[model samples]
Target: MVLEVVGVSPEEESVYRLLVTSGRATAEDLAQRAGLPAADAARILDSLALKGLASHTDGTPRLFRAAPPDVALLPRLKRSADTLELARLEATRLIQAYQDTMRRHDAGQLLEVITGAEALRQHLRQIQTCAQDEMLWFCKAQYVAMPSGSNAEEFEALARGVRYRVLYEKAFFDDEGAVDNVVAGVRAGEVARAVPHLPLRLAIADRSVAVFPLVAGGPHGSPEEPTTALVRDSNLLAALIALFERYWEDAVPLRVDGSDALSGTDGSGPAEALSPTDRKLLSLLVAGVADKAIASQMGLSRRTVQRRIQAMMERAGAETRMQLAWHAAGHAWL
Candidate 1:
């Protein structure tokens, strides 16, 4: 019965397994062993031979050989697997299309509640994979459902030409490996930015649907299970979009070159001469990251970070850190 999925009937599978165990068999031998009539066994054997699962020799009563299961069944299994995957993808598209229609016609269908961490993660992945045009994200620290690097969906979506605009709070970089993840994302065509902070975690796909927490501080911060809301096209969705755009407008762009060095220039005044390290430091500073946090994120000591800031200030003829930041902005150094 296990082989039925690949088009083998239970009776045929039984005959095939018996044949495999016996190595080779005549129609009468298989019939006696399987408790089936000789005529029925002969018919099944012919069917199996036609399916490449068995072969017959040109002799007296004829002999049937069971093809090696590995050779005969593996290819069929692979083809079946491929077909199932295609069906799954088609089902996902059909479900999305149906949901889109319902959301458009029925106002009550606009909001769906996703409860628990695993469910939240699955919805996030589904939306990202289904997204056609763009994805907007507000990534905050102390992640509620999934870790930052666990988002393989983002890369897959990016590969298919889905534009990603992600805004990370400054504290997000304080997490271990967070900087490396951001760098990897940037290299893979993600457009990343850093903000001093964000109010909540959010994701919007194609500007038609949004997902965010129904109440903040769930399993991560409390004993309660996490709860999230999937909102499709409404004034609430528009407000969420506006919230992301507001922070995005002021957030510092995160850029890294092929060499893994942060790189940027405004092409105006002294900003054009700024080094990669300087550009990175200025971006973090402008986002209100603390000196120690900056040092940690950039893999530098606190003293070393201060020294670099001092050098940058002197280069820009700045008497203080504020003046250096002011100059960096004026010349579009970040």
Candidate 2:
């Protein structure tokens, strides 16, 4: 019993044995039997009393006796030990959280310059390949309009049941080829949409990583002059996803028929609602063509195309070309 309380110490067991055999003894008698000093025996007796394993009787000379063995003390001791360990673990977790916050504060802005079109393409492919559940994209028409190897990879991922939600500009409706591709994707039923003038080009995969263009303009500039950033941190990715959802809430739906209607206008519209020049400009925008390329294609000055796009923004009530495209596509106006 004493071994269970104080562990297997030679002195404690010897003292317990002396107390048991002698029935009750003075500290001096216990010390002689246990081969320990009188002061040592007194200290051990006090420790045993504190443990409730033994008691000292009050008399002319104090004498110790082993208490009735209590089976309940073993489980009580174990529970107390477990409670203390849990408190230690909780304190460690709180300290780790504080350390992580300090680390983020110590490291401010982080930037990396990755060169080459192929490098950029590979980076996008890597994100798609690693996506386990869902991929959300807010893209300009130019990204989907222009042919690239990444599209094939993205399509393959969709085929494997990786969920996808993409937003495109109204200009996509102007390009028969681009529209056809979108229709095909819609047929697959893996992608959902809101309409057109998407200014920000962003991609999020599985809530773990995000990619976006650094340059303010759409991708229609030169591929050689592309600027983008890929983010892998979870907190930053969540913030980016939140921003995308805010824009998505105000966007229009992609499908239009008797079933789909804007509150103010009837489903039917005049042909002049969108002119040929407007359609052409939208296509160029989706293709990520520069102002010079759009101007050359339409036989108009670059400034004219820019002005028309500004006018389109006003007509669409859009702040950015990306938002304009999203709204246009959703309304089926583009």
Candidate 3:
């Protein structure tokens, strides 16, 4: 029974065990001990010998001896385990390929409508957890199924080296803790950008599948439940990916980490090196976020925000905010 997994049937094992107990046995002897027919015993013994579980001496009416179980069965079990592992890997590859092919041919498999907030949240989590290479996200204002700063999955994915490119609409920063969340993600290696507005909220994983809202406007508590679509490999998914890239090209990068923010600073650094705090402030400023909003997001008073801007202006030798923006760009400080 223990050797069955290594291709030893119960009958073969019984014949082999009998041979081992006898030290040496002919087919007739093993058949009598195993209570099997002589012909069946001979066949089983041959099967065990072929599997290296038994061997025969060179003589008439050959005496079959069970190979040392530790030496023979261990290797067979190891080989069986190795073969099973390879088969499992191949099966996974084939299943993925088959699903992709099906999605391409069947319209019904291309798009799945997910209704209700709970369902949408589950799909988002699943996609991020399954993402292998990269994840692209369009974050907009107003909470839907998942609110800003609550997607713990992104942090987990990032930790495992899944590159995340997230574009946030300007209004997204207005949400409480949004900027803090973005800073956390950037520090963890997420590439974040900002735009004045986004067409929709979307998330794509590995460029193979996408999820987007089916209804406009986020959760407003007006009894209008949110709906979303899970899109597989298709033309629509391609178009969505293209749209994200188009917007990404024009978006402004957010620099939260001091080292990374200054990594690209061009020739002749600022009069004084920009601290991490200053770099963060500068990033939001370049993104066209107002001082008041920046103050709120950065947990600073508006006066302090203006004071810091003035200080940066003096350091850049810029007379006005516009010139400071230009200086930041020329220096690659953003």
Model 3 lDDT per residue over 1-334, tens place: 7778887888777777777788888999888887889898889888888888889988989988888989987888899999999999999999989988887788779999998888989999999999999999998888788877789999999999999998888888778887777787888889877766789989999999999988874564547778889998888999999999977754556765564342211211342346566788888998999999999999989997898788678767899999999999988776
Show the lowest summed lDDT stretch of 10 residues, model 1.
263-272
lDDT of 3 at 266: 22
lDDT of each model, Cα atoms only? Answer: 0.85, 0.66, 0.83
Candidate 3 residues lying further than 4 Å off, grouped into runs, are 2-7, 17-43, 50-52, 59-61, 68-106, 116-118, 129-133, 156-163, 187-189, 222-225, 249-253, 257-334
lDDT of 3 at 321: 91
Better of 1 and 2 by TM-score: 1
Each candidate: RMSD to true structure? Answer: 13.5, 14.8, 11.2
True lDDT of residue 226, candidate 3:
81
Model 1: what TM-score? 0.50
TM-score of each model, in listed order = 0.50, 0.44, 0.62
Best of the candidates, lDDT = 1
- Residues 124-168 of candidate 1 have per-residue lDDT tens digits of 999999999999999887778888799999999999999999988
| TM-score top scorer | 3
lDDT of 2 by residue, 1-334 (tens): 5454325356665676677678888889888877789899999888777766678878857978886645425655677678878999999999977766764765332223445455666777888888888888775655522342227767778888888887665654554466556555655654545544665778888976677766553354554456667765546667889987755543444543343331212112222355566777887886678889899989989887888788667767789988877767777655
